[model samples]
Target: MAYRTWQCENCGFLYEEEFGLPLEGISPGTRWEDIPDDFVCPTCGFAKSQFSMIEI
Candidate 1:
């Protein structure tokens, strides 16, 4: 199945649903919206709301 991608607005961090961040404890196939609000960008500490969904 195809996965959705999200990009951080402040630091340009890319979050792909198909390949969840194992280091961060987020499992694969987890949707962008399913992530907790308190989850920050691993790269720049940006808030979850700062992430925008991408087509590809």
Candidate 2:
């Protein structure tokens, strides 16, 4: 699978699908689409809508 990286528009926090935020309860390999809508950025506490898919 091609994992994607999502960036927080508020704080530039990167959420890599290949390495989910385990400390935030999101397991590794979790897909971006699978994440809940209510999920917030761990760094800035911004909503999921604040994130944008980033190509790397």
Candidate 3:
């Protein structure tokens, strides 16, 4: 299993998810790759590029 750290592009909010948090927000059966590009940051509205992969 690979855990990744994702940061919000706008507010820089950091969140760690194993399978991956849902683009619509933390929910059941959420995959990182499944997240939509338009997914806005909970803290700030930013695109996926704003987020980067981090070593856990």
Candidate 4:
């Protein structure tokens, strides 16, 4: 499956599925759909819902 990148609408934080946030406890290749619903943006504290699918 093609990996996708998501960006936080609030802070421009990019979440690349190809390089999951290891510091955030997210393993590499972790899909956006697999992230917890309550996960917040590390940069802005925005809710996951605030992210939008973006092309890299």
What are the lDDT figures for the candidates, one per model? 0.90, 0.95, 0.65, 0.97
Question: Which tens-of-lDDT digit does each residue in 1-56 have in candidate 4?
Answer: 99999999998999999999999999999999999999999999999999999988
Worst 10 residues of 2 by lDDT: 1-10
Per-residue accuracy of model 3 over 1-56 as CA lDDT, tens digit each? 55567887567676666534556467644555766767666677777678876664
Off by over 4 Å in 2: none
Q: Across residues 1-56, which tens digit of lDDT does each residue of candidate 2 receive?
A: 78999999989999999999999999999999899999999989999998999998
Worst 10 residues of 3 by lDDT: 19-28
My TM-score estimates for the predictions, one after another, are: 0.89, 0.93, 0.60, 0.97
Instruction: Report how far residue 35 has shifted in candidate 1, in Å.
Output: 0.9
- Alpha-carbon runs more than 4 Å astray in model 3: 19-25
Best by TM-score: 4
Any residue pairs clashing in model 3, and if so which? none
Residue 53 lDDT in model 1? 83
Ranking by TM-score: 4, 2, 1, 3
Q: Quick one: best lDDT, which candidate?
A: 4
Q: Whole-model lDDT for model 4 versus the true structure?
A: 0.97
| Candidate 2 clashing pairs, residues 3+ apart or interchain | none
* Candidate 1 C-alpha lDDT tens digits along 1-56: 57989999998889999998989999988988788889999999989988898776
